[model samples]
Target: MENFRPTKRSKLELAAPVSHKNEQFWILDGNTVLEVGGVLFKLHRSRLVDQSIFFSHLLDERNVQMDGVVVKSDENGIVYHLSNTTPKDLEALLQLDKNPMAYYLVPPPFPVLAAIIRAATALRFDTYRAFAVKHLENAWSSSVTDLTTERKSNAVEVVVLARTCGINSVLKRAFYEMVRVAGYGLGDGEFDADNGERPQEISRADERRLERMREHLISAWLQVAVRVDRTFICPNQPKEPTAGTESRSSTLPKCPSLYSKRDAWERRVHDSGLYAEYKFDPFCGLQALIDIKWDEDEGWCSDCVHAKREVWRTMRQRTWERIEVWMGLDK
Candidate 1:
């Protein structure tokens, strides 16, 4: 076609679901088992290569367990099964193949977890807001974090993407809890010492120092976002410096050094609503963006030129409210 123009956003339609009834033989890719009708598949160097000859390989009938699995269809009409397989098993299997399609089987979920998934896939803010409120209507009676933890039903990709989109506050809360549980706290909070030191309360002075450092880091992130694409800040990357960089020079300290401080700084930034305002710059004019650069010290001081700010701004307000409730901000 002449003068063909393509859409910017992904116009991918969800594919039709695959039926398991007619399928006989199957191959396991990580946690996902791909079954082909009356066909046996072999793992070739970790890949699921179809074997023309069918083998009568099956898990012991007694050993085959009944469990729930979540299935989602991709744009290419391929169904994926996702499961909460151990990170260890995932790593072992992933090394064999790089196709993201192979993983699909998932663990059973609580009802709320199902809702979270639907809401996230739809990218519906109202649905996300309603689900979170239903779970946290009585925020004072329970630990907000605990409420979040109980609903462990989504794939890591879904949860992380929801957080980046600034939708599904509950999912984001669950994500942060995972981050915290993994022992990666903000720069302003009490930190785990790698030197075998017992964790203790942090001094107020040190906390303040951490806040400044975190602001510098976040400011730096925004600069990168502007200079590069938003994809540069992948959630999968190491939050702290790598070993090689750490050895080269101590010019930059690792995140572990200022976890507590970073936490406090983030809290202050939240309470002050700087992130919300900066995320959605009211001014989009060229001059306004230039001014943000002028005030270099302040974070997002020049965010007015952000092309995505209009959408991000509305989402920011709603997201912050959900987060405030999740964190028990009234206290």
Candidate 2:
């Protein structure tokens, strides 16, 4: 076999025609048409260029001419082909250009929010990216207990999104939520299917940082456990009967067993259920332990309760100091 000639395909087979649809915030009146994922969107070129530096350069007349963009011109405007982006994502990014108040007033669903973040970040829309970040932070910042099942499920996505977009403000809380909902073995897929699946998205460096944080947290929890263990106050001893007045001139009331009481208290404080609660309630920390009251029937003395509370305060302060450091948010 010497030189061989390949058969050419028809234009229709080579490139299928895209169907245009009028979507939210983009219509026929728009100056530019963009075909994304087989769907066409009519939007203003100036609005996009103004919002994203990527678009500003990408759509520049010189670049467009040199790159020989696949475009079609009609009475409406010029159409450009955009590859590798879905129509939903492009719509989400364009929605940002509408009334700013609407974004906050009518919050989108988590899927829509994720799409907005992904598109904004990819297109280098700084303002839109920040807007997406604020919405994400607000959506999840409420009490974790109040989060719906769906919202709880999205915590891992939030962490990946925050890290990928360089939104440090949300990264700490997002990471904490992920660990709370997913546990130390986040890479095991305990929380979400996609969690830890995309190393390119989260990065090996970030994964290592998370592992270090887990180690620090384990150490902190052990410290808390130790503090809880040593919090019991030793009973006061009755003054030894003077040299030899009488072996027992006055009988002393019998004291409750300190060892047994201490054991019970430790069990309550260190229960796995309570520890799980602490993971989600980061702000509460050891305060949750202090809030626990001993049953009157259990015969727990006020002195021991007070001692436990004091120990909890100390533990909380220490743990708080380590939180920022472990989360890599100290800066």
Candidate 3:
């Protein structure tokens, strides 16, 4: 209810010297005081110094002073002003010790987790940042299959998180996954696919990129689907009829007409609404196409089926490679 009293750290130090000490963090016997957003927090110097490189060096005449970590001292010992951070964010960082297990066992929600990570990064708290990052890595695994099981809702948040935290490893995948949120995919198995759930909000620049990528991604998927290359020979089928009707006669029935395999594949695509579903999820959709044993549909034969599957697989990889560029992440 008063005003920020300044000492000599910066012209911008916003520590309130009178009428305020954060009720939650003021410790009676604490050695150091940190003031952020006009509220003071009295805490142990060792708790911060031991866990953070920035804090370790901060308890000195020449401090990194980073962005906050400024201000005056009194009966509470050396007061450091952390005006650059929010009181809530500072509390989240300090509370890590009170609830260390929460970071590992049940992890905080993204909002809480983000506060911790952001504060940690600013304060050079490596352990705290790593703890939060581990949870993100788990959610955005390199394996797309594992990622599929995650809520598509999470991908957009991760895109922002990855960029904020400087976690480049997860950025591409997160952006790729976000395509589904923009109405790219008709549906996926694990996520809320009724098109009803609200996707996380992202920057307008990202929204524009997604719109452009959506058009290109659908085109890439169609490239593979429309090819439907031909091969008369069914490799898995023996050329010579061994014993009974078990031979090529029953299996091949007859060599499919020029484009019968293509037609049959198209029919199935139309039936499955696969085009709609896969437009946004090119990598997964392409893989799904590859995994199928096409011969079963219209007697295309194992050789032809495997050959087409190989083409689909190649397209899957190609799609994956282009995703970064498509999403504008390459820049």
Candidate 4:
């Protein structure tokens, strides 16, 4: 008889099945098994889990051999086990996929904005506002030309919060540009912070982005306003750039007088000290002034002093409540 070879082999004949039932177990190459219930798996391509279940066993720096394929668990729940591949471990396994510098240059995902906003609010830092502005600005810039449903909703939220928190004029313009680009119609609905809908027309991705931005702005605004005079950017001179060689130049240029036609009128406000008035008349009704179609009948009339006072009073009350919460006085 001629020599015969079997193409199919039974599981028992091929190799022992790796059991992960009661004890922790990992099988490599469908043949090599490593168990770590109490016993640790020591391999050139393996790593032990850390004590804290929060994060996975960090890869050892010196023992990392790039030549051979190696994999480790990221206990962060950021990654999963099974080929042990997951989105969370993406940062660690990044070296295997691309250059390190390339990964660093990429902007973090939208979800990171939420965490950043939370941290900034907790720290009572205005720097978070700037970051929130930057992210919104970038989101607007990216989505403007695209005009997808997701982009429009994000743009709207950015516009609303950037205007409300008074982040910066530059960022404010970016948010506005996004609205114009996306062709979103405001309709009968108003942009009132307390009353506006969750923006159903928006994508879940953009909605999450806006939520983070709003959280940062509102939290930071409340914290700073209650603890310090947030009306002024800084105690001394808010206009002076904090970091730079050219902070306080005596010859700093002044803005072009709005009443340039009447230099005498300019001199009058300057002489009367009205020019130094803490509240700016131009910024009065900024919400209404910026939006041409906005209806002042929406109870935001510029001439209503009583209404303005009531608004301020309500804002102060909310401010106190936030401060109490932050200081743990409420608890």
Candidate 5:
């Protein structure tokens, strides 16, 4: 982090009297002044300290005899330089403090929301942090699609933001949502397609988390596939031979024919190139299998396809339920 130093006043300026003028409507009768990204804000120290532990500790360290360790003194009073925070972010935080109800009524855009979360986390503003998380959760849950337009674009950044702010629940959901839509392998260029703007790059540590999640999801799919192989039955199988047909029973029973149908279904899944597709794209694979059309001429019965689709649906639902646990986020 780079340090932003305030302008130094000459020794002659120390003897000059200081006068204050109201700049913004929210200035009020504030004793502490702050400069963020070249914009000045006149706000009360007590109000800020009360809301944020970080602010409380920071202000407590300043010497009151020196007018609370002035960073810059002018006609607008003394100002403290707040490094790395933008004017917009500081304004949003102050607005939330002044009128929280109004702020929550109309949520900010994603970029502004990200800035607010970052500033709130750094300043240790617990109330604002919780408020942001609640809004994010609402945004995520309101859409029924695998991933909403906003979520598709911002999910990656939100994962990083949630981890930084210590919002574990959001982090887990965001990660799961990303995997659900984007699949196992995501290239850097594909990230920008969700929104026109380029997304913030995730750190290598976060990248590893995504990789681990993809591995778990793939394992879950493979397990479901194994279960399907063991339990699926061919609908075309004939009933067992009735009574004793004697010489007519010399012919092979129908059990081999039933097994052959099952084998053919499995072979078609591989031969049609779906098996390879499923390895890279699990959700799409499940969808493709669900929509499969069986032809009588191809030795596949409609009843068999229907039964297989039902099994796939059940497995998919079960896999969804266990994803959070597999990712170590159930707690």
Candidate 6:
């Protein structure tokens, strides 16, 4: 055989398979080989099996090969091909899975949370999925009283998470929050937190909804909110004495008027955004209206202070309801 195979070899035959390892998660002596996005990850077989039943069955030693690749070349080798999961997601899962004790204490960042939920859901890691959902429920809380609660993810990210995990408890709140912050519309480039390197995957429908809500909110703000408290009379201001029923000496102390207060309120409205370049954040903006100190010493009685607080409270609730209607989420 002058040798059909002797003189030369093709690049395909000469080249070795290309794959990368994530040093952050690659464990020494890990028995299972997991691949995502052409990157190989070595994970402890028992640990993965312990975390998910799907992994347990998928990594069974009884199955020797998958798609012609030797899944278990021997007891020392075990390969599992993963689909519909990204490297970042798998990496997040690896981090979370390795430390079960920490999950209860340290909540992951938004990016990590998004990644874990997506991967855990696809991989059937139920524990991680539930944990992520609970954490997110707090993050996107709908309660106006909990406005001070720190949040790692914004409404945009929450929308993505809700769609991915099918969690609806926070969807309405998320849609409301989206209009509060985001001004982007269809054809605008959005940030893809799920895959930083990829283009935004947000649908045009989402953009349209936000656009409509934003416009409606502005209209509601101008028509209803502005008109609701254009004038606030101090509830504690003494009423005009009825026909001088008693002597002038018996007159109660008059509550001094804050002539500039209404002007200040209007200015706040302008500062927080009546239009584009809005600093309006319903969670903070509505609260800001109430934050004005109504001190009894400043001519405001306790009743007046209470009245101001109550007005803002009612407004906040009303805004939420209006948001539901604008978004077509209202029943």
Q: lDDT scores for all predictions?
A: 0.33, 0.63, 0.69, 0.34, 0.64, 0.66
TM-score: the better of candidates 2 and 6: 6
Worst 10 residues of 6 by lDDT: 64-73
Stretches off by above 4 angstroms in model 3 are: 1-24, 61-66, 73-78, 147-151, 183-208, 230-254, 291-293, 327-331
Give TM-scores for every candidate, taking all chains together and pairing residue i with residue i: 0.19, 0.67, 0.73, 0.21, 0.60, 0.70
Candidate 3 lDDT over 194-281, as tens digits, reads 4455544566787787788778877887776654645435454457656664565565435566577667777766566776677666
- Tell me the spans in candidate 4 whose CA falls farther than 4 Å from its real position: 1-8, 12-92, 96-98, 108-300, 303-331
How many residue pairs clash in model 4? Answer: 3
Clashing pairs in 3: 69-81, 69-82, 70-81, 235-303
Q: What is the C-alpha RMSD of each candidate to the true structure, in Å?
A: 24.8, 7.3, 8.1, 19.1, 8.9, 5.7
- List clash counts for every candidate, in order: 24, 0, 4, 3, 0, 0
Residue-wise lDDT of candidate 1 within 219-297, one digit each (tens)?
4335422332333222222446676665433542222223343343355444545444433221121112333332234
**In model 6, which residue pairs have backbone atoms overlapping below 3 Å?**
none
- Kindly report which residue stretches of model 2 are placed more than 4 angstroms away from their true locations once superposed: 1-26, 49-77, 83-85, 140-151, 181-201, 226-228, 231-257, 270-285, 295-307, 327-331
Candidate 4: Cα lDDT at 101 = 39
Model 4 lDDT per residue over 11-107, tens place: 7867854423222222222222223222222222322222111112233444433322234443211122232222222222222122323324464
Please report, as a residue range, the 10-residue window in candidate 1 with the lowest summed lDDT.
49-58
Task: Return the top candidate by lDDT.
Answer: 3
lDDT by residue (106-183, candidate 5, tens digit) is 887876677777878777788897897788776655222353223245777777677776776666556666765554
lDDT of model number 4? 0.34
The order by descending lDDT is 3, 6, 5, 2, 4, 1
Off by over 4 Å in 1: 1-158, 161-167, 183-331
